[model samples]
Target: MLIQPVADLLSRNADHYLIPADIVANVQTDNNLYHAFLVLTKIKYSKIPVLDHAGHFEGLISLPLITEQMLGFDQLNVEVLMEKRVSDVMETQVKTVPNVDDVESTLHLMIDNPFVPVVDNDGLFQGIVTRREYMKSFNFLTHEIGKQYDMIEKDFSTSEKSK
Candidate 1:
């Protein structure tokens, strides 16, 4: 049976883009150096995307990077630590999937990179899909398939009655 593509299951809701208001204030090039530490701390537990002023995709910052810096450095000052902008720290070369791609292709892409960014033809950030989200899509697909079968069966019965 044909299955809906992964793009169909992506959380198109705007809420997904809402970062935890309290977690880490969005980083700015002029923001404090220590802010990066806070942002890194937040990423330790969550996989969040970083964006630049132009709203272009930036590389993901994780807890490990933060921890490494903390360990290697003598002082944790913003200028010393936060010298890198999200643009500098982020993975400049990002792997993105098109909105129209099929679920199988999306899943494969996710497998290749657990944190895959979804982008439009113009490379605008649509949303991000983690491994967990991909699995959730699979489960959602299972239910949809069952629902389709029930509808088909109902239609078949109705046709028989009409005859």
Candidate 2:
């Protein structure tokens, strides 16, 4: 009942790979810009995923976006940033994938996004399948293919020597 040829694609490894909550800087929709800045700086993430109080995936907030907006103002201070909401500067047009969906689609989506927000059926926040995880899967599969090819070559050579 095993399907070896396409087994790698059907593997549940990436689907089950869950990201811990502590890794993401979940900037809330109502979170003040100053607070967002503090968290982003501490984590050193170029961009961050935004979540609502109900734990729904909103979009993303980037340091570049904040800096671009802040540069327009004369008095650039923490208080000035505190006056704004992360929602005000966030890019709502983000790429996201459903947790139940196939992880391959997510992998392809990651080409444009370094981080794809994992969402539930109701569009709630789950975790993430980062580039690191994706790359690991790719490397493992590549190694597997090479291993299979070597085995087949060795079998062919053994049979030919008997002739």
Reference-based TM-score of each model: 0.57, 0.78
**C-alpha lDDT of residue 1 in model 2:** 34
lDDT of 2 by residue, 90-162 (tens): 9998777777245667767888888678888897888887877767766777667675544444458878889
Candidate 2 stretches greater than 4 Å from native: 1-10, 21-23, 73-78, 148-163
Q: Against the true structure, whose lDDT is highest?
A: 2
lDDT of 1 at 124: 56
What local distance difference test score does each model get? 0.52, 0.75
Over 1-163, each residue of candidate 1 has an lDDT whose tens digit, in order, gives 2334424444432234222323433444333335656765655553445656665555555545544555634664435465554444544566666552445555677666765666667655666656665566567765675654443434588788899
